[model samples]
Target: MSEADLIYTETLMQRGKESYTGKEIVILGGGDGGLLWELLKEKPKQVTMLE
Candidate 1:
């Protein structure tokens, strides 16, 4: 991942937790689904993952 992507993800995680809002997650490109799985643990309503 690029530096910008990392920053954005960290920011998202923080905001999501603070606001207690589950995001409708979406991913583009290809890679492992580990991140999505982790997000699910945070009780996100749905993950519209595309890989």
Candidate 2:
């Protein structure tokens, strides 16, 4: 990941726990499945990626 991507991921980490924890998350346009992998680290109820 690029520096900007890392920064953005860090930002998400800050907000993810409150918003995504234990919630079903659907990611649209996630062809590479990167977002799905990232979110899975948070231990959500479920995570789905659609391309």
Candidate 3:
């Protein structure tokens, strides 16, 4: 993963790796789909991206 992806997917959430676990996530304006890709690794309940 890229540095920005790491930051947004992990560091920015401030809960580390388990941040997205079983959670519903919505991503706004992630046109490149990088954030979606990284977030999926955490196994969130659902992920919706609008771009």
Candidate number with greatest lDDT: 3
lDDT of 1: 0.59
lDDT of 2 at 33: 55
Give the Cα RMSD of candidate 3. 2.5
Superposed on all Cα atoms, the candidates' RMSDs to the truth, in angstroms, are 4.6, 2.6, 2.5
* Lowest-sum lDDT 10-residue window in model 2: 9-18
Better of 1 and 3 by lDDT: 3
lDDT of 2 by residue, 1-51 (tens): 677776676575565446677988877786555566677877899877778
Error of 3 at 41 (Å): 0.2
Q: Top TM-score: which candidate number?
A: 3
lDDT of 1 by residue, 5-46 (tens): 656555755745553247566666425554554566767767
Better of 2 and 3 by lDDT: 3
Q: Which residue pairs collide, candidate 2?
A: none
**Tens digit per residue, CA lDDT, model 3, 1-51:** 678666765554565545788999998988677778878888999999899
Tell me the whole-model lDDT of each prediction, alpha carbons only: 0.59, 0.70, 0.77
Off by over 4 Å in 1: 1-21
Query: Which 10-residue window of candidate 1 scores lowest in summed lDDT?
Result: 29-38
TM-score of 2: 0.63
